[model samples]
Target chain A: MNIRTIITGLLLLTALICPALAAKELSGQEILDKSQKLNEADSRAASMEMKLIDKDGEVSKREVRFWSKGEDKRLIKFLSPADVKGVGFLILNADSDDEMMYLYLPAFKKIRRISGSAKSGSFMGSDFSYDEIGSTGYNDDYKAERLDDENGQFKLKLSRKDKSDAEYEQLIMWVSQEAFVPTRVEMYKEKKRSGKAYLELRKVMTAEKITKTGKYWMPFSITMEDVKKGHKTVLTMSNVKVDDDVPDDYFTQRYLQR
Target chain B: MKRDKPILCLCLLLSLGLILSLAAPTLAAASINGEIKLDERAYADGSSNQISWNRAEFKLKVASELSGQAAGYAELKLRTADGPDVSSLADLASKSKVSAYSLELREAYIDIFGFPLSNLDIRAGKQRIAWGTADKLNPTDNLNPYDFTDFLDFGEKIPTNAMKLTGYFDNTTLTLASLPVFTPAAMPSTFDSSINGYINAYLPAGMTLVSSESQLTLPNATLGNSMYALKLARTIWGQDISISYFKGYDSVPNLSNLTLTAVSATQMASALTMTYPEIQVLGYDLAGSFNDIGYWLEVASFTPDQADQTVISPAGTTTTEVGQYTKYTVGWDYTFTYDIYVNQQWMHGFFDERGSTLSDFLITRIEKKVMDDDVLLALNWLAEYNNGVVGNMFGPKVSFYPADATEIELGGFNITGAAGSTLSTWANLDQVYLRFKYSF
Candidate 1:
C-alpha cells in the first residue's frame, strides 16, 4: 500500500508543476525588453572598428573607442585616421524630452550641438544612422507585436509609436530565444501620398559573434547596410569592459572636447 | 624695451613648461604625438602669378600625467614659409632679413583636476581658454589674440599666457581666468596698405599718416594690466546657456598717440603712437539643437574706456570719440540626406570691426561627401554689407582623402564688390590654393 500510494502521489504532483515550469512563450514586448536589458550597464568601455564598404566594395576602416555610462549617456571617440583623430560624439538622456547630443570635430576645434532629429543622418559617413548607433532598444520607441516563431527565434514587428518622430516607420526583428538578443533587423520607411501609406524596407542590420559578459549579452560584430545607397558599415567590437568606472561627467560637452 | 619684456616673460614661462615637461616623474607617464603639413598657393591677381604662399608646418603635442590628480600638456610648433618679412615684427624697424623659418611654443599648460576641492580644476601657464558655444566666429571669445598673419588660415588664435580655474557643479560649470600678458592681433603683409588709412582716419586734417614702418604700442605685462574673465554656464532644456564678462584691452589696434610737426599751415608730418584701446566686454551665448537644426547665438557688448582719438595740430586739438559698439553672431547647421551638410551664420560685427557703426556679414558653407567619404566637395561664401555697399567672396573646394591620414585639397576664392568698400580693397586678391596634409 505504501509504494503504490507514494508513486501515484508523486506522479500527480509532477503533472501539476511541470506545466507551470515550462517555457512561458514570451510576448514581443517582453522579448524586446529582455534583449534591451542585456545591453544595459552602469558603465561600459569598448574599442571598436568600423569598416565602410562602398558600392564598388572598397573598404576603408576607422578605429574608435566607445564609453557609456548609466542608461542615458554614451561617448564614442575616433582614435585613427589622421583627419578625424580626437573627434568625439556624446549623447545623453536618450528618448527623453531633455535629451542632449554633441559632436566634437578636432579640425574645427569646436563642439557642435546635435538635434534629436539628426538621428536620421548617417554617423561619421557610415551607413549606420545616428539612431541606429544608439544602444537604446525598441521597447520605448516602438509598439511590438509577436509573430510566428521560426528557426529557434521569435519574430516581432515593431511600429514606431510616433511615426513622425523617427526616421524609420517600422522594424522587423528576429530575436534569439536562448540569448534574448536581436540577430537581425529590417528597417522600413513609410511613404504617404494621396491618402495612401505604404512601408518600404530601406535598411538592414545583422549581428554576429554574440557573447556573454558576466550577465550581459553583446554582439561583437554587426553590419548595417543601406539598400538604395548600396553602402554598408561593418562594426566589430573588442576589449569590452562591462560595468567599468566612467566619470559622471564623461558624457558632457566639456569632455567631448577632450 | 617694453616689447622685449613680454618676450622675456613668455620665455620664462616656456622654460618653466619645459621643466615641468621634463620632470622625471611626469616623463615616466608621457605620450607624444606629432604631425607635419605642407601648403602651397597662387593668386590670380599677382603680376607674375607667382606662388602667393608656400608653407610647411610641424606640430608636436606631449601629454603627461604629473600624478594621480594632475596632468600637463605641451604643443610646440615649427614652421617655414615664404613671406615678405613675417615671423617677427622687428623687421619693421631693423629691416631684418625675412625670418622664413621659425619655432614657437603654441600651448603649454598644467591641469590640476579636483585641486583644492572635489569639483574644481586649475590650469596654469601659456594656454588657450575657449569661452563660447558658437562656431569659430564667437563674439565672446576675446581671451586669445587673433592670429591674422595668414588671413587665409582664418579662425586661428595665438595662445596667450594665462591661468584658468574651473568649477564643476551638477549640470553647471563656472570658469575664471587671468591673462597677464596682453597680446595684440597679428596681421598679414597686405595689412600694411590698410594701416595708413586706419591711422589717417584718426589724425587731424593737416597730418597725413605714414608708411609700412608703423609699430604697435603693446601694454606691458603686469598684474594691474592683466585681462580677467569670468563665465558661468549651465544646461537648460538640453541647451548650453552662458553669461561671460571680459575686462581687458582690445586686441584690435587703434591709434593712441601721434607725433607731428608742422610742415605748413594746413599740412603736417606724422609719426606713430600705435596702441590698442581698453575695453570691457559683456557677453552672452546659447547653443543647442532643436529638431534637426543645430543653432547658436553669441553676443558681446563693448564699452571702450579709451575710445577717443586726440590729435594736436596747428589749427587746434581734435578729440573724436569712437563710442561703444556691439557684436553678435547667430548661426545654424543641418545635414540632409545623401551627406549634404550646410552651415550658415549671420554676424553683426566682424572680428576686427569696431566703433558705433559696424558692418554686417553673412557666411555660409555647404559640403557634400561621396565615394564612402573619400571625396568631399565644399562651397564657401562670405558676403559683407557695409552701410550701403555690398561685397561677396565665394569659393569652391574639393578635398580628396587618398589614404588614412592623407588629404589633398584644391580651392579658390573669387572676390567681387562695388567700388569703395572695405572688402573691395581685396577685390584683386582672388586666389587659388592647394594643400597637402598627413597626420600621425
Candidate 2:
C-alpha cells in the first residue's frame, strides 16, 4: 500500500474516533496554540535510558543525556559504547517540518551532517526511527483535527501534509480538559499498530506567570510500547532547569563536536 | 485408463488439501525506497560521454511471518532503465541480470523458527549468506562479488541459491550452507569479451560461475553443479570481539600439459584445451571494537586441484610447484566525528612462491558530511605498486538531498599507470554515476 494512503486513512480514522471539539469550537490555530503552550513554556535537560525488546525477546538498550533549551532545540549525547562516549548530536529547527542536525564522531574527530534518507532511519539502531524524534515540532507539517471531549479533555488527531515527512500514518493525542496539555499520543504507521506512548507528570516544581497556569505540569517522563512486539522504550526527564538562557551558537556543529 | 484417471483426480485433491492445511497466515511489512542522481565526469580516455536519466530502483515488498513454526517472505523489484536487455553497469555487476524494467522475485525463503531445538534455526530455499569479516570487500561476499559502483542493492539481487542451517546460542552463531546446484558465470569485469575469448582467456575449464557473464546468452554449461560452505562465529570479551572461520568450494581453471609434438597443427590458439580443477578456499576472520576504534583482519588461502604446469598465455607455461596461494588484508576503522569515518587498510599476497605474483595493495579513505545534513562528500585514494608494475586510482563522490528523505549522489573515478611500466600512463576513464534514492 502507498505510504501516503496509509497516513491519510489512519489520521481520518483517528479524527472520527476522537470528536474534535474545543471551548469555542476553536479554529485549528487556537487548538494548536493551546497545545503549544505546554511544550514551549518549559525546557529542561535530562538523562534517559531506553530499551527495546523485540518480539523474539531480543533486547537492545541505549542511554542518552539530552540537553534541551526550548521546544525545538536539543542536544543528545551517547554515554555507552565507551569508544563513542563523547559522540553527540545537536538538533535545531531550520524551518517548519525541517530540522538541521550534526553528529560528532569522536573517532573521526569531526562533526558531520547526516543528509537525506538517513534521517528516516533508526537512531543508533533503536526501534525509534530518527525522523520521529528529529521532527518533534509538528505545527508546520500537520493539519490538526480537534475531536470531541471526553471527561472534559480535548482530543485531537493530526494528519501529515506530505508523505515524505515520516513513516507514521497519524498521531492521536489526548489533552486535558482544563490544562490543555497532551497526556498521551498513539502513533500508527501503515494502519498497523506501531507504538503507543503515555506521558506522566511527576510534579510541577514551579510555574512562571507568563501564561497558562493549568499547563504547569510538564510531562517529566514518557513510556512507549510497540503494539505488535514485546518491546518498550521509556524516557525520563530530569535536571529540570529551564530558561537558562542558552545561546543559539551553542547548538552549532562546532560546539557539538567539542 | 479409467482407473488411472480416478487415481489422478484423487491425488490432485489430496495435494491441494495438504497445501491448504499447511498454509499459515503471516505478518508482512513493506517499504518504498528509491534514489536519484546528478553526475559529472571527464574520462581519462574521453570515449562515450552522455549525461541523462540514471533511472531509479523502485521496489515493492510483501513479507509475511506465519503463526506456525514456519515463515517466508518475497519481494518484487523494478528499475527505470529502458530496453529489453540493456544491463545497468551496477545491475550487471550485481547478480541481477534481468532488465531493469523487468520485474523479478527478489527473495523467497521458508524457515522453521523453533525446530528440533529452540536455538537451532533451519531455513531452506533461496537465501543470501554473508561470510568473512571485511565490510565492503568481504571475500565471503563471495556468494556474489559486488560492484562497489552500485549501491548496496547487490544483496537484493544476487542472493545465493542454497539452504542454510544456523544455530544461535548465547551470542554465538554457527551456520552451514549446502548448494545442491551451482552454475558457473563470468565476473562483470569480463563482460566485454567474446565467449570464445572468455572461455580461452578468463575462465578455467573445471570451475562453474555462479552467474552468466553475457547479457545476450544463456548459460548452458554446468560443472561441479554442487557446492557447500560452513561458517562459525562467536562473540567474546563482552561482545566487543568476534572471530569466524569459513570454508567453501570454488572453481579454478587448469590445463593438462601436452608436448608441442603431441598437438595437431590445427590447434592454433586452441592448441591446448583448458580443464577446470576443483578449487577450494579456507578463510579466517577476526574483528574487534574497542571504545571508538574497530579493527578487522581476514586471510584466505586458495588450494588448486593439483600442482602442475599451467599456461596463463599461449606463449609460456608456469609450473605450479607451489601447492597453495594465500591473500590477507588487515584494516582499522575509527570514528572521530559523530558522523565522519576513516579507514586504513593493507593487503599482501603470500603465494606459494611459485604461483603468479599479485602485488601488494594499500587503501585509505576519509569520509565526512557537510551542508546542513543535505550534502555528503567523500575522497578516497588507492595505490598498488606491484613488483615492477604500479597502478593508482583516485575517486571523489558527493551526495545531496533536496528533500529531507531522498538522496542523489554523483561520483567519478580515475585510473593511471601502465600495466607493465610505472612510467607509462594508461589513464582509463570510468563512467560517472548518478544515483537517487527514496526510502520508507
Candidate 3:
C-alpha cells in the first residue's frame, strides 16, 4: 500500500474506535450510585407544600418547613392549618435497621418515639408513605438492573434486596440522561402464588418540574398517585437551600418542640 | 379558682398578643392561629333523652420567634358550655345575652433554645409539661392535672403554671420542672356520689348516710406545696429509656377524715372530708419497638402520706394505715394488614385508686380508616378489676372529615359492671355524642 492509502485506512479505523469508546455502557448499579451521588447534599432546607386530591376531586392542602443534615438526620414541622400547626417529626438513621423517629403533637404537648410498622403506613393521609419520605435513594435497598435506554432516558428495574425490610417489592425507574436523577418511578407490590412470586402495579410517582441549582439538578415538584384508588398527591418544594449551615441539634427533640 | 380570674387572665393575654401583633415589625417572627369547635351530647336510654352538653369553643394560639435562639407560644380558649338547653327560640336569643361564656388561658410559655449553655433549654410560663413515651395512659406524666369535665375525653390534662428546664446531650436529656402552687383535677359531675360510695365502703357497719354532702379542702398556696419533677432520659439501642421522680400532692382528693354521730338510736349523721395528700413517685419507662410492633413499659412506685382515713365516731374510733403502692402500665400498638390499627394497654392503677384497693385495667382500641382516610371508625374498650369485682366500658366512634381541617364525629360510651363497683358508678353516664370541629 502507498503511504497516502495507508494513512486513509488508519483514519477510518480511528474513527470507528472512538465511537465504540464513547458508547461504553454503564451498569445499572453504577447508574444508581451516580444518580444517588448527584442527588446528595451535606444539608438541605426547603419549604414544602402538599395537596391531596381524592376521587371526588376534593383537595386538602398543607404547608411545612423541612431541614436535613448529613445522610441520617432530618426534621419536619408543620406551618399551616391551625389544627396541625406546631406538629413536628425528627428522623435519624432512616431507611436502615437503626432508624429512629420521634413525633411531637402540639395539641398534647407530647413527644413520642415511633417505630415498627408505622413507617410503612401513609404519611399524614398523603399518598407517600413514611418509608418513601425517609428513603434518600434506592441504591442500598434495591438490586438494580439496566432495562434499556429509550427516548433519551435510562430505564432501570430495581428489585428489593430483602422483602422483609422493603415496602415495595419492585420498582421501575426512568432516569434523565442529562440530570442523572429519576424522572419517573413505578412501584409494584409483590404477590405469591403456589410458591412463585410476582409483582403488580400499585403506584406511580412523576416529576413534574426539574430545576438546576449550583451545578446540580433536582426535582422541584412531584406527584404521587395511587391508580387503583384514584387518589393523587402533589408535592411542591420552594425556597430550597442546600449545602449551608445546619446545626446538628436541629434534629433533636428540643428543636422538634419548637 | 375565682369565676372571674380566668377572664382577667384572658384579657391580660389578649393585650400581650395585641402588643405582640402591633410590634410584629421588629419581633423577628410571629404567627397567630385559632380553631373553633362545637360539641353536643345526649343520653341513650329510651323515653328520657337528656342533653349533656351544648358546648362551643374557640381556641387561639400566638407564637413568636426571636432570631434563632428563643421563642414564645401562648394559647387561649373561649367557651360557652353546660347552659340550659333552649326550650324555645326566645330562650336561644336571650341566653346568649347573659354572661354565660367563660374564657381560659390554656398555655403560655417561652423557650430559650441555647443560652448559658449550647445544649440546654429553659421553658417558663403556665403550660402543660408532658413527660412520657406511652400513648396517653402514662403513669410518669404527672406535671399537669387531669380534666374530666368531658368524661369521654380521657387523658386530657389541664395546663398548670410551671417552669421547666431541659438539658440535652448526645443521646441523653435531663428535664427539671417546678410549679408554684397545686391545682386539683376536674371530675365528672357524678363523681361525688361515686366517691361517697367508695368512702362508705371503708366505714364501719351501721354508719348509714344522712345526706350526701362532702367538702373538699384545697391545698394551701405555700412554698412547701410547690410541685417538682425530674426526668433523665437516654437512648439505648434505638429505645428511649427514662427514669423520673416527682414530688407533689395527688391531683385527686381522697377521704382523709370521716365523722359519725347518732341522731337517733338507728339514724346516723355522717360527714366526710376530702383532701389531697402528699405523694412521691419514682418512675421508670422503656419505649421501643420489636420488629413491627411498638411497645412501652412504665412502672412507678408511690409513697402517699395519710392515705388511710381517720374516723371519729360515737360508736368508736378507727384508724387505718395506708401503705405504699406501685402502679404500672404496659402498652403495645401495631398496624395490621389493610391499615387496621390496634392499641392495647394494661395499667395497674386508675386515678387515685391506690393502696390495697388499687385496680388493674386493660384498655384497648381498634381503628380503621376508609374512603381515603376521610372517615375513621374506632372502638375503645376498658376492662377493670379490683378485688374480685370486674367492670368494663366500651366506646365506639365514627369520624368523618368533610373538609380540610374539619371533622364531624358520632360516638357513644357504655359501661357495665356489678353495683357499687367503680365502673357501675359511671353506668349512668352512658351517652352518645356528636362533635363538629373546624380549624383555620
Candidate 4:
C-alpha cells in the first residue's frame, strides 16, 4: 500500500500542475523568440552591398563595408570620392545608454557631432537618412503586435511608440517563421493619402565561408519604392568580411575623413 | 520716406504688360518639382514636449523662349502641414487646424536673352539675387538680408513678395527689385490677445511701427503698403561682391489720435517723445570660396535712432538709450571631405550712439558626418555677451538613420548665463530635440 499509493499521488499532482502551467501563456516570450530568429537570418555582412539603381536608371554606386558586433552594434564605412576618402561612422546599441553617433570630417581635421534631430535628414545628399541605416531597435520606436500566421511566417502590426518617432503612424512587416527575417515592409507616414513607401526583400542569403556562425541569413538585395519622388532605390551587398580583426581606431572620425 | 503709392500702382500695372505677352500660344519646357518632408522635434525645456508633422510641397516651374531672344520662368508652390500641434510656436502663439494650407508665389519672372546686348541677359519679377562671397553672413550679398525670425519658422522662405529686374554682363550682374513695399519686422504689441505675452516678447522690432497698447490685434500690416529698391552684384578676378539699398515707410497703425492724447497727458510724456523712424537699411556683402577655404562678410545699417527715459524707484531716472543698430557677420566654411564640412561664423551688432549696448548677439558651430553616412556628429558653441542677454551654449549632437536615408536626430543645447542682469551668474538650460525628415 505504501509504494503504490505514493506513486499514484505523485502522478496525480503532476497532471494537475501541467494544465495550469500551459494556461500561464508566454505570448511576450514567443514574440521575442520570433524576433531573435528574424535577426539571425539578417546577421551576415557580405549580403548587403552599396549600389542604388533608381527606377529611372540613375545609378549611384559606392564601396560600402560594414562590421557588426554580436547582435546589438555595427560600424559601416563609406569609401569613395577623393574628398571623403577617410570618413567613418561608429554606432553602438547598449542596453543602458542612448545610441551614439560619431562622424569624422577630413576638412576640419576634427570630428563633429550630429544631433538626433538631424538623423532623419539625407545622408550626404542621398535620399537615405543616417537614421535609416542604423539599427532599428524594436524597443525604441515601435509596439509590435503579432497579427497572423501565413505561409510559414508571422505578420506584425507595428504602431509608433511616440507620435514623433516616425512619419508613419503604422507599419506592417512580414517575418519568416524559420528565419525571423522580414521579407517585406509597408510604410504609411503621412495624412493617409500620400507619403507611402514599400520595401520588398528580393533575395536573402545565409552567411558563408565564415564557419564559426552558421545560423545567419543576410539580405543580398532589396528594392525600395519612393512613389512621391517617382524613383526606386536598389541596395546590393557584396564582399562582406566580418570579424576579421579590424582595429577599433578604424571607426574613428579620422578614418572616415581620410 | 513716404511711399510713392501712385507710382507703385503704376509699376504693378506695367507688370501685367509682360503677362499679356505670354499669350502667344507657345510650347515651353515645364517641370514640376516638389519635396515632401516630415519633421518632428522633441523639446527638452523640462516639459519634454514634442512637435511632429509632415508637409508636402509642390512647385511648378514653366520656362519658355519668346520670339528669338527672350525667355520666362514662373513658379508656384502649395504646401500644408499635417499632424498634431506640437510646434513650439503653435503651442506658444498661434493655433491652426491641420487643414490650414497656404499658397506661396515663389518665383515669377520674364527674361530677355541675346538681343543686341553682348553677354547680357535681362530678367524681371519676384526674384532672388544672392551676391555675397561669404558663408553665413554675406555682407556683400545685400540683395536680400534674411529675416532670421521668419527663416527660423517651419516651412517658410525669406524673399520679398514683389517684382524685380536684373541685367547680366560677363561675370557681373546688376539687379533692381521692388521691396514689395513691406516692413522689416512687425511690432510686438500688435499681436492678438490669444498670443501669450512670453511668445510675443521675442518678436524683433525692426522697422515696423507700434500704434497703441490698447488694441491687442493687428490686421492691416503686410507687404501691400510698401515701395521698391535696387540690388547689384559683381564678380572680379575670381571674387564675388554685392550691394543693395532700400527706402520704405511703415505707418504705425492705431497711432491716429487717442493713444497720442493719452500719452501726451501722462508724466511719461518724455517717453512718448519716442520717435519711430521710417527705416532704411544699406547692406553690403562679400564672399569668396577658394580651394578648401571660403570666407564671407556682411554689414547692414538701420537709419535714424531710438532712445528712452524710465523711472527707477530708488535710483531716480534711468536713461535707457536704445538706438538703431548695425548688424555684421563674417564666416568661413572648409570642405575636408566629399561629405564633411566645417563651417564657422562670427558676428557682432553695433548699436547707434542712442541704443543700448546691452543687446548684442554672436554664434559659432562645427558640423560633420560619420559612420558610413549612418551617423552624423556635431559640436557647437554659441555665446551672446551683453547686459540682460549674455549666454553661452555648447553641446554635441547625434544623428542616426535606421533605414537608408530616413533620419532621426537627438540634440542637446547646454546654455548658461544671466537670466536678467549681465553681472549675474549663469543658469544652465538644456534642450533636447528629436527630428525626423523625409525628402523625395
CAPRI band of model 3? medium
Candidate 1 lDDT over residue span B1-440, tens digit each: 43354465468559757876667564667766678888888887758687878889888777777565887888787777576454456665532235445668888888887889978888898887776777778889999898877857775788888889988888898999999889998876777667666556655654553332445777888889999999999988767999999999888787655555566555556665667888899999998877668889999999887766666545567677778789999999888765588889998887777787788989999998876677999999999998899999999999998877788999999998877665787887888999988887
Q: In candidate 1, how many Å is residue B366 off?
A: 1.5
Report the lDDT tens digits of candidate 2 across residue range B48-97. Answer: 56432345555543334445466665444545443334346654553224
Model 2 achieves a DockQ score of 0.02
Interface RMSD of 3: 1.2
For all candidates in order, the CA lDDT equals 0.80, 0.52, 0.83, 0.48
Better of 2 and 3 by DockQ: 3
Q: What pairs collide in candidate 3?
A: none
lDDT: worst 10-residue window of model 2 chain B? B26-35
Docking quality tier of model 1 = acceptable
**Model 3 chain B lDDT-worst window of ten:** B91-100
What TM-scores result for chain A when each predicted structure is judged separately against the true chain A? 0.87, 0.70, 0.88, 0.67
Name the runs in model 3 displaced over 4 angstroms: A1-24, A192-197, B1-21, B85-99, B198-208, B211-215
Q: What is the interface RMSD of candidate 2, in Å?
A: 17.1
The best candidate by lDDT is: 3
Q: For model 2, how big is the CA root-mean-square deviation?
A: 19.2
